[model samples]
Target: MDSSTTRTKMTVEEIVDALRDKIVVQELAPGVKLREIAVASEFGISRPRVREAFSILEERGLIERTHNQGAVVARQTAGQIEALFDVREVLEALAVRLATQNAPKGTWDVFRERFGPRAIKAIETNDMDYYVEAVNEFRRKTFQEANNEILSQSLDRLYDRTRVLIQRLVLMPGRAAAALEEHRQVIEAMIEGDAVRAEQLKRANIVSARRWFQDFKKFLL
Candidate 1:
């Protein structure tokens, strides 16, 4: 029996995440065809659900749809990475500022509860994936506190692609501890209702990360 005959069932979101992870880790290289029928067969899902997952991946910039070739993983260039980081820095900084104004009481408490100790633990143990997850969760909480759907959606679109770039940045020498401290400052500013200060701290944090990527690009690329 052909191994391809076996199938695994998963929800549409699960399928999207699975495919996105593959793309992020370069398991699915750029320009590889994503045949809907084959994917549907593998996942034991319908073509329609697979299509939905494709659209989601496309929106996240993990894949692209051609006029006739269907979907393939998106190829990113250095200039594209620069532009994405520029836009992300501005938008995420704005998110923190808005969050200062709009955040509900106890929001910072919840964020701290989820990330503070866990973030430090991840860094000390060299647990890259766990650290990245904590950072992403922190970003999500910032969006939620900001209470702006449009801003949140815009940032969401860039996040998956950004994650691909930063997968290595967190592991850079001295980066993990610095990032934790930066996040702490940003959260403190938001809790103090200091919009301008929070925005500045957030932008500085993002810029610092971008610089790390620039310095390390020789190895990463």
Candidate 2:
């Protein structure tokens, strides 16, 4: 690989993406120290750039800087996970309700088209990663249809902070299939323009996910 070609200028955003990917994929394990010099050398960037990325990651709740330890991946307790999901359930319930009230005709059609087949594929392959990605995509589309910029922005930040933990939890046995069914139900409610039912179903689905995570906490943490 050409050195210059492989070493493109990395903005703070790109650095954050790199670090986030590593954390999300568990390449950077929880509690692992992320030293600036090592990270900068590995990415072929300056230490300042690495520090910039670390700051963004810290803001996203993925890492924390300690006096002697530098930066380490943030750890989530079982109680914290439950609380996060509880908050997510309420927020998503509101989002679905708003979307149903204001969604354009066929607003959910894009979700049906994109997620329908991918969901089937996930079930057939039992691929937890793909299933989690699909579910996140569906939820994002649902929120987007609400057409509320403030809600979208707020939910986006919350999701970003908890997404890695969510992904890990979803990989437990039986969760992918259960989550697929829940997604279908959410879609059904949205399609029928039943805002009340949509909100209820969305909350139920998230609560179910929270329970699943709770049960699998030993395996996860």
Write candidate 1's Cα lDDT for 42-72 as tens digits.
7777788899999989878899998888998
RMSD of 2: 3.1
lDDT accuracy of residue 40 in candidate 2: 77
The Cα error of candidate 2 at residue 145, in Å, is 2.0
State, as a TM-score between 0 and 1, how close model 1 is to the true structure.
Answer: 0.79
lDDT of each: 0.83, 0.79
Pairs in clash, predicted candidate 1: none
Q: After superposition, how far is residue 89 of candidate 2 from its true place, in Å?
A: 1.1
Q: How accurate is candidate 1 locally (lDDT)?
A: 0.83
* Per-residue C-alpha lDDT of model 2 across residues 94-178, encoded as one tens digit per residue: 9999988888778777666555777778667876666666777777777777888988877876776677767766677777777
Clashing pairs in 2: none
